[model samples]
Target: MAKYSLYINSDCSLIIEFEEEISLELSRFILGAKLAIEKASLEGFVEAVPAYNSLLLIFEPKAFQVERLLQETKELLDKTKSLAPSQSTRHDIPVCYHESLAPDLAYVANHAGIPTEELIKLHSQAEYPVYMLGFLPGFLYLGNLNKALHCPRRENPRPRVDAGSVAIGGDQTGVYPIASPGGWHIIGKTPISMLDSSRQNPAIAKPLDTIIFKPISLEEFNQYDH
Candidate 1:
């Protein structure tokens, strides 16, 4: 296990920073550290937010001494070596890649120098790791997109991108959890709802989860609406 830097961020939070690059190894460590910290049940521990290569530990200043918390956190981190990265849930999200839904399909295919069908195949074939969740309530920052399919975000941001819109920006890919303006290039639309405030767990996926995009016909997508 590599030594991670632990330091106070602002006045009430601690930041655990690992290697700067993004990799499965780093992600595993981050996840393990988060789980171990949660299990420790330290006082004033509000939540641990996992990112690609770090974990942000939020706590209440009044509930615990900072020095004591730091010592406890270091101890907990030492135990992370024994903690295996938790088994991540794989979600086969259904996406409609048809022309009507995938407005940028042609553009993306042209940019990749491949046929639209081939682009869809490459996009849907790989199982992406959920690196982090950000930008929106259920927006999943998925990683490891095919090199051939890598593309930059649109020069002009869309005024509004519909919910369930699967998009790619730079080397990362993600889904829009709600209708909002975005710069990512939309490749398809998933029928499955990724976020719902009414549900206990609003987001269907979380950090370290595996997401598999399954291409579905327009008819199949319509079935989800009923």
Candidate 2:
């Protein structure tokens, strides 16, 4: 990985870029940078947010000058190069793939020329990585779906997707934590509250978390709902 000069934004943010594309290595690099920044008790360091191919470092000016922090951040980035990848935390998310639950199951199955059962099997088999949290609160963008299952977004997006709606777009899979307009083909729904703002920890998954979807019956989902 080639390291470039650190980029400082007027918003008290610094960006250290290695690559411009998304990959396992890039994700690991983002995580490594995150860990390094968090570990440093720099007076002005506010928060570090990781994206598809870069990390955003936020700081305050009163406690730490931008110029000094920029140098310190570059040092931190250099240190991350020697660190190991994060040991991922696995989360088994339960999904109910019933016809009633998965409105787009028929369409997705037809598009792949596969039976619905096979479609469900393919979806639940892979261990997806938590790429980033964006677009919505606690809305996960997991990657590496079985390529055969890759499909385009709905031609007409629904005005309001149900909360806990599990859907797929292209080669990525995600869960809708709140009802909102969505274009991803809905294939299932989970009872898990991935984003409960009332809870101390609102987001259920974090960057580098491994997500394994477990299929459940509608009856089982109802039982958990209660």
Candidate 3:
């Protein structure tokens, strides 16, 4: 394992960056690092945010000296590398690709030079990795989208994208956990509630988890909606 680079991102945060590319190994390492750091309960630790290839640690400057924190962080990283990778949960989320649910399905298929059915087949067949959670409370930035389904964000973003909208932007795909302005091309909608305030863990999926899209009929989606 290569040494991860650690640097102070801000007065109260430290960034631990790994390889520049996105891959399962890098995602695992990032999540693992986060788990390790949290388990260590370093002085003044606030939280650990995991990304595709990096982990950000937020701490209180008043509790520990920056120099000492850096040394301790490095030692933690070295020890974490030897520990087993964290286990990841797989989530099967149902989605409806009906015209009403997927307003841009036809356009996306045309843009990809494939039939609508083929595009849906490709999208649903592959499993995606939850690289990070951002943009919204429960929004998951999933990766490993099929190359054929890769498409750029809309030239003009929609002012409001409905929550549970499954979208593809550039090389990634994600669900809009809340209604918000977005530039990604919406391809489907899931009936599942991705974020629930009442739950202990609000987000259904976490970093390094596997997400598989299971296609459902419009009627089935309607039942779920009700």
Better of 2 and 3 by TM-score: 3
- What TM-score would candidate 2 get against the native? 0.91
Residue-wise C-alpha lDDT for candidate 1, range 1-226, written one tens digit per residue:
7469998885789999885677777888888889889988899889999887778999887775788989999988887853244678899999999999988989989999999999999999999988888779988889889999999889999999999999988888888989999999999999888998988768997777799999999999988972
How many backbone clashes can be found in candidate 1? 0
True-structure Cα RMSD, model 2: 2.0
Candidate 2 lDDT over 1-226, as tens digits, reads 4354578765667876664668777787778778888999777788888778777788885664877888888788777752254477899999999999999998999998999999999999999988888899888888889988998999999999999999988777899988999999999999988887887658897877889999999999999852
TM-score (all chains, Cα) for each model: 0.94, 0.91, 0.94
- Looking at model 3, the pairs that clash are none
Where model 1 places Cα greater than 4 Å from the true spot, the runs are 82-86
Tens digit per residue, CA lDDT, model 3, 1-226: 5457998898888999885677777776676677788999898999998876778899987774688889988987787753233567899999999989998999999999999999899999998878789889999988889999999999999999999999999988889988899999999999998999998779998777889999999999999843
lDDT of 2 at 214: 99
Error of 3 at 72 (Å): 0.6
Clashing pairs in 1: none
Flag regions of model 3 displaced more than 4 Å: 82-86
Give the Cα lDDT of each candidate.
0.87, 0.84, 0.86
